[model samples]
Target: MNIRLRSAVAGDYDAVNAIIREGQDEHAEALPDRFARLDQVVAMGWYRSFSKQPNKEIIVAECGDKLVGVAMLEMKQSPSFEALVPRTYAYLNELAVASTHQRQGIGKKLYTASLAWARERGASSLELNVWEFNERAQQFYASVGMRTLHRMLFTDLT
Candidate 1:
């Protein structure tokens, strides 16, 4: 199957939302307290707002006439502070491939496009956050040459 990667347009709202909702549903099921499944209206609205950010982009993977995957990216800079190094980077806010279309290299295409987009815009690095419960996602990311940067820990104070 041929997969085409391109910048998303306003007309892609529904398809993109559907793909995102799949991932959201999984997250919600795995961690009810941390993830909430969004309704279509709310998801679409949030996508609209997020896509409009000046330093953000939404990349979609299309198979023939269907949108099967999406990657949301954001350009960010490390804050100038005494304890931090200054640099610009690209953040992979979200990446989701439709349940029916996984393992066909669509995710890799989206990721390649995202990296190129960041490189073209002078970003020095690419980063993303994956929840521990999503082992599949972690494995996919690792297969693409990403490694653990840091771990976020939390305590239940109850």
Candidate 2:
């Protein structure tokens, strides 16, 4: 397929949201209910605010006029989880390619664009969370030189 990579615009939100919803469904099916609540959270407007944040960006890969992949980035000073926190970082909130487009390099292209955006802004590190069982994603991240830094655990308070 002929794919074009570009920065996202406000007009792209619907397509971006569709990709997110589909990705989240697959993600939810593989995880516990606690984390699955993200589908609802995103649907209720959380992700809508992401692109508006000063430090956040969303990129899309399009085949003709159709969006085939997306990557979302959040750049910020490293939070002081401890008093001795390190340098600035970019958080990769989401990176997804349409299931039909897997293995076509859309995800990688989107990731490359995101990394350039982060590096241009002086971020020292780029971080993201991938489910432990997502071996394909793990391999992709590893291929692009992302190392596992931490494991996130979730609990349901509801």
Candidate 3:
């Protein structure tokens, strides 16, 4: 029952990646191959680049020194499409929890920590994307006060 969460260090990349793979496997039956591969690679690369970017933060949840979850936050500027909104925003690009520890508040703790981290950095808004068919994820976000604002579609050229 003892669990802790903290910002990811360079040494935690592999653990973070492992958590991602495990979480993805839980929904592999519903995800497109291209979506799956590209997202995984992008997540790994984020960890690799974390050392160079002061604005990008990736946090890991650990239990007795073992990484069980990860959350990534990036300082972002509002897109031009939304001319009415402020420019400074926060993007939560990724958040994954190991299936073994899910629903035990590990994911919530990671999210809460990431939110505080984003706020401390002067982010005006926080945003993230979930796959359209991932109802479980959408429900989680909703329970956390996030609303469905738009629908995002994708296609594979390969």
lDDT tens per residue, model 3, 37-148: 3345446565777657988888888889788898988898766686566578788888989888889998888888888988898987688988877888989989888887
Q: Model 1, 122-146: lDDT tens per residue? A: 9999999999999999999999999
User: What are the models' TM-scores?
Assistant: 0.93, 0.84, 0.85
Alpha-carbon shift of residue 19 in model 3 (angstroms): 0.7
Residue-level lDDT tens digits of model 2 in 14-98: 7787778776776677775524635333443555666667788878899987899999888877667788667888989899888
Position 82, candidate 3: lDDT: 60
Rank all candidate structures by their lDDT, best first, as comma-separated numbers. Answer: 1, 2, 3
Any runs in candidate 1 off by more than 4 Å, and if so which?
Answer: 41-46, 49-54
Ten contiguous residues minimizing lDDT sum, candidate 1: 41-50
Q: Judged by TM-score, which candidate is best?
A: 1
**Model 3, TM vs. native:** 0.85
